[model samples]
Target: MTSLILLSGWGCDARIWRPLAPHWPHGLEVKAPDWPGYAGRPSLADPTSLTDLADAMAEDLPADAVWVGWSLGGLLAGALLDHLPAPRALVLLGIGEHFVHPQGVSDTALADFQRALRRSPDIAREHFLRRQLAGEPDPTGSRRALRELLGTALPAPFATLDAGLEHLAHLDIHHCLSAASCPVQRIAGADDPLLAPEVIARADQRIENAGHCPMLSQPQRLATRLASVATAPDAKRPESTS
Candidate 1:
C-alpha cells in the first residue's frame, strides 16, 4: 500500500491536517509530520539549503510515500524530488514554483508581515492566520474554527518562521519541475486570493470556493481532489478542473 505524506504551510503545525483526516480517500496510509521547528519540533541541524530541510522531513517517511504539500509545504516537496528516495507522486497545494505571486501575496506584503512578526511572534501568527483565509465563503464560522484549531499551538520562535521564509525568498523549482522523477499534481482553492486563478487553473485539480487552507474551508472537496492525485499517473500532464 502507498503512503501519503502531508506537509503543512508556514506558521502552521501538522495539526492543521485534522479536518481532512476523515476525508482521505481509500487505499493509502497518510502521515503528517511537524516540519523542523514548527509545532514545537526541533529545528534541523545546520540546515543550509532547501535540500537540508527536505532531508530532515524525509527521515521518517517511506521511500514511496506520495508527498502532499500546501503552500510553503508545496515548495518543500519540490525541493525533495531529487533528495528523497523517490516518492510515488507529488501533490502541490495553493502554491506553484515560487511563493511570490502577481495575483497573490507580494514580497512587500510578506516583508511587512515579517517585520511585524519580529516584534511579536504571537501577534504575527494570529494575524497571518487570519490573513491566509481570504475569500472564505463564511468568514464568521471559518474564522472561529480556524482560531480554535490554532489555539495556543503557534507563536513559534522567530528562527523557525525565518527558516521557512528563507526558502520562500530563494527557492525556485520552475526549472526543475521538468526533471521531477515522479508524477506531479497541483491543486489550489479556486477562491484563494493568495493564488492567481490562471496559475491555479494550471493545476491537475482544484477545489471550488475554497481558499489557501482548503482543508479548513472545504475538507471534503480537497480530500476528494487529493484522492485523484494519489491515484494519478506519474506524468507532468496538467488537468484543468474546478
Candidate 2:
C-alpha cells in the first residue's frame, strides 16, 4: 500500500492539512510532517541547505512514499527527491521553482517582513493570510481557517524565520523537477498571486482554483487528485522520461 506524506509550509503546523486528511483514498496512510523550530516541536540547530533539512525530514518517512508539499515545503520535497529513494509520486501546491519573489524584493519589503516577524506574530499572521488568500474567490473562510491554525502554534523564532527566508531567497528547484523520475502533479489556485500558471506549467498534472493552501481551500478536489495520482500505474516514471 502507498503512503501519503503531507508537508506544510513555513510558519504553519500540521493542522494546515487536517481538512484534506479525511478525504484521502482508502488504503493510503496519510501523515503530516512538522517542520523543525515551529509549533513548539524539537528542531535541529545550525542546519545548512534545503537538502539537509530534507534529509532530516526523511528520517521518519517510509523508504518509498508519496509526498505532497506546499510553498516552502514544495522546495524541500524537490530537494528530497534529489537524494531520497524514489517516491511513487510528488504533488506540489502553491509554489514553483522558487517561493520567494525571484527578482528579489526591495529592502523595504525585506525589512517589513523581518519587522513583522519580530514585532508581532499576530501581525505577521494577518499579513501572511492576506497574501496567501490574495486571489482566492472565497478568502473569508480560508482566512478564518488559517487564523485558527495559527492560534495553535507558538511564535516561530527569529532564527528559524531568518533561515526560511534565506532558503526562499536562494531557492531554485526547476532542475530538481526536471530531474525527478516520478510523476509530478502541480496544483494551484486560479487566483493565487504567488505562483503563476506559466511557472507550474511544467507539471505533469495541473489543477487550478485551489490556492496555496488547497487542502483548506479545496479539500475535496485535492483529495480526489491525490488519490488518482497515487493509484495511477504511471505515477513512478523515470526522471529522464518524466
Candidate 3:
C-alpha cells in the first residue's frame, strides 16, 4: 500500500484533514501528523528554519510515502526535498510558486495580517478561516462546516503562525518544484480566491466548486483524485539541475 502523508496549512493542525477520513480510499496507508507547535507539539528553537523543520519531522515522514502538502505546508514540503531523501512524489495543493502573488494577497495585505496576528491571535484566526471559504460555492455553508471540523483543535502557537507567515513572505519555490528529484504534482481549487488564476490553470488537476479548503467542501472528490495519484505508477526522477 502506498503511504500517504497529509500536511496541513497555516493556522491548522492534523484534525483539519479528518473530514476526508471517511471518504478516504481503502488499502492505502494514510497519516496526518501535526506540525511542530501545533496540537500541543513543542515548537522548534527556530521555527523559521526549513532545515530545522525537516529534521524535526524526518522520522515521521518516510521518504517512500506520497507527500501531500497544502499551502504553507506545501512550501515546507518543497524545502524538505533539499534536506531529506526525496519522497516518492510531492503534491503541492492550494499554493503557487509565490505565496504573495500580486493578484492574490499583496505584500502589504499579508504584512497587515501578520501584525493583526501578533496583536490578537483568536480574532486573526477567525478572520482567516472565513476568508479561506470565499471561493467556495457556498462560502457560508463551508464556514459552518469548517468551524465544526476544526472546532476541537487548539490554534497553533503564535511563534509557529508568525514563522509560517515569514515563510510565506520570503520563500519562493519555483526552483524547488522544477529541480525536484521526485515527481511533483499540483492540485488546486477551481475557484480559489486566494490564488492567481494562472496558478489554478497550471494545476495537474482541480476540484470544482471548491476554494482553499477543499477537504471540507469537496472531500469525496478530493479523496478519489488523491487515490488515483497514489495508485499510479511511480515516475522516474528527473536529472538534477544542481
Candidate 4:
C-alpha cells in the first residue's frame, strides 16, 4: 500500500494532524509521526543539527511514501529527499526552501522571536502561535483553538527548541529543490501571514481562507487537497533560477 506520511512542524506533535485523519483518501495508509523532541519523545541529543534531526526522524517514515509536511516539517521533508530510498513525492504546506523572507517573516523579526524563546519560552511560544494565525479572519478564535491542538512549543531541554530555531534561521533547501529526483507539490494557506501570498500562489496548489496552520482552520479542505495530490500524476518540479 502507498503510505501517506504527515509530518508536523516545530512546537507541534503528531496530534496536530489529527483533525485531518478522518478525511484522508481511502486505500492509502496514513501516519503522522512526532518530530525528534516533540510529543512524548525525550530531548534530542546534544549539538542537534538539522541533518542529525532528519536522520532521527527517518526511522519513523517509509522509504517510499507521499510526504505531506507543514512549516518546519516541510523543511525536514525537503532535507530528507536525498535520504529516502524511494520517496514518491513531497507536498509542502506553509513553507519553502527559505524561511526568512522580506515579504514574509523578516529575519530581524524571527531573530527577535528566537531570542525571546531563549529568554522566555512559554511567552514567546504563545506569541509565535498567535502570529501564525494573524492572517486568518478570526485570529483570536483560531489562536485559542489551535493553541490547544498543537500543545506546547517547548518540550524538555529548551536547547532542542533553540536548535530548531537555528535550523529555521540557517538551513535553506535551495539545493534540494533542484537535486530532488521525485515530484514536488507546494501548498499553502491563502491568508497565511507568515508566508507571502505570492510564495503560496507559486506553489503547485494553495488553500483558501486559511492561515499558516490549515489543518486546524480548514481541515476538510486541506484533506481534500491531499487526496488530489495523492491521485494526480507526478507533479513537475519548478526550475531553479539560481
Worst 10 residues of 3 by lDDT: 233-242
Better of 1 and 4 by lDDT: 4
Using lDDT as the yardstick, the better of models 2 and 3 is 3
TM-score of each: 0.90, 0.84, 0.94, 0.92
- Segments in model 1 whose C-alpha atoms lie over 4 Å from true places: 153-155, 232-242
Clash counts for the predictions, in order: 0, 4, 0, 0
Whichever of 1 and 4 has more TM-score, that candidate is: 4
The Cα local distance difference test for each model comes to 0.76, 0.69, 0.85, 0.78
Per-residue error (Å), model 2, residue 162:
1.9
Candidate maximizing lDDT: 3
lDDT of 2 by residue, 1-242 (tens): 67778888877877888887678777877888788776776666764455666667777555477788888888778777777875777877777767655332334565577677678765775676677776665788888887776673444666776677666656777778788777777766655666655655545555566656677778888888777766662553324422
Candidate 1 C-alpha lDDT tens digits along 94-212: 88888877567778877887788788788887777777786777766787887677776563567878767777767777755667767778888878777776787776776787888
**How large an RMSD does model 2 have?**
3.3
Model 4 segments more than 4 A misplaced: 151-153
Q: What's the TM for model 4?
A: 0.92
Writing each residue's lDDT as its tens digit, candidate 4 over 42-84 gives 6567525655766677777676778888898888788777666
- Candidate no. 3 TM-score: 0.94
Task: Look at candidate 4 and tell me the lDDT of residue 1.
Answer: 49
Query: Each candidate's root-mean-square deviation in Å?
Result: 3.2, 3.3, 2.3, 1.8
* lDDT, residue 162, model 2: 67
With a 3 Å backbone cut-off (N, CA, C), the pairs that clash in candidate 4 are: none
Q: Write the per-residue lDDT of candidate 3 for residues 1-242, one digit (tens) a residue.
A: 67889999998888888888898777888899889998889899999988898889998789888999999889888888888898888888898766998888889989999999999888888888888889988889888887777783446778889999999889987787777878887889999988988889978888998999899889899988777777883443433343
